[model samples]
Target: MTRTELQTLPERAVELLGGEPDDTTLRRYLHGLAGVDAVGLGQRAADLGTRSIKTTSKAWALDRIIELIDLTTLEGADTPGKVRSLVAKALNPDASDPTCPRVAAVCVYGDMVPHAVAALGAAHGDPDDGGVSVAAVATAFPSGRASLAIKLADTAEAVAAGADEIDMVIDRGAFLAGRYGQVFDQIAQVKQACRRADGSYASLKVILETGELTTYDNVKRASWLAILAGGDFIKTSTGKVQPAATLPVTLLMLEVVRDWHAATGEKIGVKPAGGIRTSKDAIKYLVTVAETVGEEWLQPHLFRFGASSLLNDVLLQRQKLRTGHYTGADYVTID
Candidate 1:
């Protein structure tokens, strides 16, 4: 929660697990996690959605949303030209205004990693250093339906091409079929695959794809499983599925990160991707984060929004905040 007091983490995970994460022990630790109260969880998220941060604070939240965004473009038709355009937008969301903060990263398909890095050039590095990062979706991306060899290769290729982050979808089928160990093992191996030749590793954001998780309990278990398996961030979706991201699911994952910090002092990140289209929607999530995990968890490394069109809306609202009047949708570039 209080990330201001948090230490800089290793380039890779330094063993947050207890004992070997074999099937039996992994299952025992996951199942030992407290069950979610569906009604209470839903109600709590609803309540946070109503808290207001108007005027100046709202302006601050809008820009913070921009900084936290992964500025994503994960379409099947993604090309090098389109990735360069996305990289430009990440570098300067509002070309008219020099003060607009750049996004945290330009998330693209694995094949687009090279194009993104090349487009970014000197402007690509750690987001904390005022440089945008390039996050590539790997491990078979939205489906997680590939062989482990394919998945590892997918991850390795992205890192090899200079991806700073890897967003991997978990095997929902394996988890749903009660193969917890398999899911855990795949994530662990993917984590290993994220290692670059220089020995530094890409940050792994495990996409739980909660739409298929089917229950709050499963989301909770998956959150802990991802963290224990060394996910730097527990993301809600691949944005290809229905019901991609929701406040309640994000809240539940935030609770896991919060509790995990209390237990191990490890600050795991939580990302709620998809369907978060407007500054209004993004502000609700910001409020949720500040309340659940403490305001300090609101950072480029600790939180991120996987989005494409969300940036268009935030840019519009930011114009309204500065000019005291709304701009036409045409003023904001559509992703």
Candidate 2:
């Protein structure tokens, strides 16, 4: 579609949910989506994975992967020092190569937003403008088992602290229990809370934690649900789950985003967090995104990799391409 036809929503606009957000409406819409053919989906993903790239294309893919990384540090022991180091790495992912592109954002816990923002300083802003964004995980990330009041407070605190993006986890319990409306309301409320004082809202990435969702059909439904609720992105995991971000699950989510764009003339982002630690694996995802959605979704705003070690591997690959020789594991910084 042309740029004029793309129905981009204002950051603070009402949700894309056209109908009443009641449970009945949610159930019907969700269940009404075409069922996923597991065998076919998996086979497609595997088939795409086998499509190799030329040396020049591999070099391009390596850099593109770097730009898509959400240089993340989320842990109980996380501190200002750690965040600063992460920001440093983000600013210059490859210290030896000044031409190396910056990462899309530095993802941290909500409490660390201030530190991340401070460290990013003048470099903190829109990814499109060559500035790295600060993404804070809120809404009781990973577990998402908190009261609505606390969750809103969490989001508000992050936005107040200069977070450019908010990665919120959906109430998977509610979703799995058939309370789709509750999940929808929570996402919508979180999106509202992401609004800043000036009225612009922080980008909201709704994490589905697909590993726990149990079925590909549920992943597709969750993707649509997140988009309808006004999520700027639909993420695959919190990076805490065991089966985080498999190729098939991400492919399913991308298909949903593509269908949504086709029907509504709007675009939504997708992220596959965790377990994607190699350039080869990441390229498979890139191939899938290109074939399923379109090459336009490759931008940082439209796609992301929620990972830590993934960067190290990409860096190593990049170095190898530059020098035409193998790089040892010690070549890249430890995450």
What is the lDDT of every predicted structure here?
Answer: 0.86, 0.86
lDDT per residue for candidate 1 within 22-118, as digits (tens), equals 6777677778878899999999999988765433365678789999999999887888999999999999999999999999999999899999999
Residue 326 shift from truth in candidate 1, angstroms: 5.8
Error of 1 at 170 (Å): 0.8
In model 1, which range of ten residues has the least summed lDDT? 3-12
lDDT of 2 by residue, 1-335 (tens): 32221134433122444467778878887898789999999999998776644332666788889999999999999999999999999999988999899999999999999999899899998887789999999998879999999999999999999998999999998999989889888988898898889877888999999999999999988888887777989999999997999999999988888888887777888999989999878888888888788778888989999999999988888888788885443222211
Total backbone clashes of candidate 2, pairs 3 or more residues apart or in separate chains: 0
Model 2: ten consecutive residues of lowest lDDT: 3-12
**Per-model C-alpha RMSD:** 4.8, 4.4
- How does model 2 score by TM-score? 0.92
List candidate 2 segments past 4 Å from native: 1-18, 52-56, 326-335
- Tell me the lDDT of model 1 at 238: 92
Whole-structure CA lDDT of model 2? 0.86
